[model samples]
Target: MPVYEFRCQACQRKSSFFVRSIGGSLSPACTACGSREMSRVISGFAYHKSMATIHEESGGPDRPGSDYYKDPRNIGRWTEKKFKDLGMEMPSQIQEMIQSAREGEMPESVKDLQPNLTDV
Candidate 1:
């Protein structure tokens, strides 16, 4: 089985079709506009990751002493890994604070976390 994507020349709309056999010819008709003049399109595909793999690579969010800011040396690498794992933006304030902490100047925002730091 193979999935093929097509784009309508008239309406510029894109549609996808899943064919059972590779030998079969695809009817590149635009579903939206019913246009016969369509072109096969390059489309992106989905990728999946298991939870175990994600946790292994991301250091699972619940793990203790695994805070990115715990060690000064982990400043840049940890922050990047955390943000990449969570698939979100690191707030500018937090980013600035991390940079400051990396430079030996702890920011006031994270001062309360000082006592929680442990030797990893």
Candidate 2:
């Protein structure tokens, strides 16, 4: 499916329409104003990253930097990876907590888990 955005002539608001096929017809009306006069908008584009590229960007599990934990992308990454590495399914409760953390609300119990170290 492809998404086509349009600018409404009457309300000047933007509306997007999802087409099932590239060659299919899409008559997009302004969802806000219900106007049929829409001008096709040239949407900005983006590309996806492969697993290798993503792993490389995060500095991988074995070599995470001091600031790696600060990255929002790594929010619940370690817990998920640890479960996968152990060949275990993450519990639904833990999965919910991780998802919530990723969505921006940190679980009170899991906050401020900075590592503690001593000269050994």
- What lDDT does each candidate get? 0.66, 0.69
lDDT of 2 at 52: 54
The estimated TM-scores of all candidates read 0.37, 0.44
Model 1 C-alpha lDDT per residue in residues 6-100, reported as the tens digit of each score: 88999999888886787787787899989988898866631122444554654533353455445675555555566778898988877778778
Tens digits of lDDT, candidate 2, 1-120: 456789999999988787688877788889999999999887762113244556676674456766676766666566678789999998888777766776777777445432321211
Model 2 residue pairs with clashes:
none
Clashes of each: 0, 0
Residue 94's C-alpha lDDT in candidate 1? 74
